[model samples]
Target: MKTKITDFFKLVFPSTYSEVAVFLFFIVCYGILGSYIAIHYRIIFDNRIPWDAYFSFDNKSILMTGGSFERHPLSYYFFNWVREFSLFISGGKMDVNFRLTLAWLSNIIITLNIIQVFKYLKNIIYLPLWLSLLITLFFGVFSTNIILSFTPENFTYTLFLLSLYNYYAAIKLRKEEKIPATALSLAGITIGGLTITNFVKVFIPLIFEKDLFRSWKKFGNALFRVAITMICFIVLYLNRIDFKYQNIFSKTNQQYEKFSNVKSMPTWDMIFSFFFGGNILFPGFIMSDKHNMKGFNFKGLYMDLYSSVIPYFFIAILLILISWSYIKNFKNKWVQIIIISFLIDIVIHCVMRFGLHTSYIYGGHFVFVYPLLLGWLFFTYRTSSKMMSFLTLTVAILCTYLLVNNIFRMLEFFWFMENYYQ
Candidate 1:
């Protein structure tokens, strides 16, 4: 048991002193940022009402340990149990500090994600130290990720789990080994348990594991494992609701339709602005005249096509580079896995238009793909000095722009929250 625990720690943690330093640096940075945001949130918003409904997050319920278990199966239990432990430690006076603790927890997860990106680049993708660090930093400062790091939502946890699973798959792929059924099932349970829809992503790696056409035994084994995972998830979910499963499908679909934005904006604009650009770039803030059930007026930061062409220009360049990289590394299995996983989000939010209006909040689900895909781009051009230098410079510039733009916009958001969100 001791050896197994040590091995698990070794597998999850930074292996080198430099990596550890990087991890700690981000921990402090995000910690301070999350603390600032949480303090402001506690001061600005009425905790009695779900003021965070604008972001589609139930901050009050989440902090108070009553997260929506219907949509997020295990989130309520997870937060409830954590809050119970915290209350016990603090002698039942943890209420004042619970929000801050949750913020720090999110920061820790975000920092771990950074470390995973760094390791995946340095070890599996084999990018240069400088370039890997740049891309990892780029991932850290994404507009949606910055919001998620401090927002106290399930999305941050989903981001961490998905990144961990992807990193595990990448390591296995690098070793030329198939992912074991047990590992896949565990991943399915955790990731799917968090957000039922993401269960599909856990199996995507399996598709790349073997050619199902010829590997009948492997296919059957994978199916059996998937069945087990699904059965376990269903049992847990049903048990949570006392096996009252009659209206589950209708209720879930209705909730999804309530959030859909098929008519809110033009499809092309939604695709370019919110789906692609808004995840990484800040857009103009829009506050609606209407109020929700809690009498809190909803607000959103959105990109407009006519507002400025600058965002679209950046989006076009990124798409072009990603396309170039995809074509160049089409034969690479890891690249394929990353892109396919990303496309899943595109299909769900962009094509299907589910929650397309607030797609930016969903960035945690797929934003990591940006850095990973860019890492593959760096790998593809590593042999060509000129191309490598050009790509490096371009990414550095993009990262710089993103960092400045996102930080400024974040401050703007805070100002808006303070003065207007009321």
Candidate 2:
């Protein structure tokens, strides 16, 4: 048992000193930010109104340990267990300190995501050490990620799991090894359990693994594993809610409409500003009055084309680079996987128009793809010295701009929360 436990620990943690250093650095940075946000949240925000209008999150449900279970079936139990453990540790009292503890834990998860980004770039993508570090830093400073690192929501956990899944799949592909059914099922359960839609991403690796279209045996095996995973998820979900599944569909349908109806802008504007650009760039922050609500108002941070054209400029450059990478590396299997996973988000937010208004908050689901795809650009042009230099220079400028813009915006948000959120 001791040997097995030690092996598992090694499997999960960073093995190299450099990886450990990077992990520690992010943990401390995000930990301090999360603590500051949690302190403000406990003092200012009322527990009645949902926080979605503010930070694009349901902070009331998350803070109260009763998550939106219809959509995230397992999140309620997960947070409840954390709350219980925290209560036990605090001798049955919950206070600001308890919120701070949860925030710090979330910071660890966010840090781990940064580590995974670095690992995937260094090990699987096979980029240079300096380029990988630069891209990882770029991902770390994303406007959405700064908010996610501190917000105690399912999205933070989902980001970590998705990064882990992608990294695992990349390693398997690099090794030319078939992914075991058990591994696939486990990935399905954890990733799908958090957000049901993400379950599709877990199975995408299987498409590249084998010619399921040509082989009935492989197709049947994949179907059986998927069926088993679904059965297990249903059983666990039912058990979690004491078999009260009747109202789930109705509740979810209601929520789907409420969340998806935020089509205030034109479709193209929404796609460019919120869906793609807002995830990375810091947009104008605006607060509006909600007279119907007793003590709070709605807050939004999004791009306003009328206010500035800088966001569009950055978005244009990013899209051009990603398009170039895709066209150049269309034959690369890993590139295909990353693009497919990214397209899933585009379909959901841009095509289906689910939560289009606040699509920036969903950056955790697909923002990592930007850096990964960028890495492929470097990989593709590795032999061309001029192209490599140009790509490096372009990425550096973008990263620097993102870091400065996002950090300034984050500070503005903190000031707003401190003085005005109430």
Candidate 2 weakest lDDT stretch, 10 residues = 298-307
- Model 1 C-alpha lDDT per residue in residues 291-402, reported as the tens digit of each score: 5466555554344432587778877888888888899999998899988888888988888888887777788788888888899999987899999989988888888888
Query: Against the hidden reference, what TM-scores do the models get?
Result: 0.91, 0.90
Worst 10 residues of 1 by lDDT: 43-52
lDDT of 2: 0.77
lDDT of each: 0.76, 0.77
RMSD values for the candidates in order, in angstroms, are 2.6, 2.7
Candidate 2: stretches off by over 4 Å: 1-11, 39-50, 89-91, 210-215, 241-246, 290-306
Candidate 2 lDDT, tens digit per residue, 2-105?
99578445445676776788788888889888887767665222455555546567655665655666777777767777667756665765566666767776
* Residue pairs with backbone overlap in model 1: none
Candidate 1 global lDDT: 0.76
The TM-score of predicted model 1 comes to 0.91
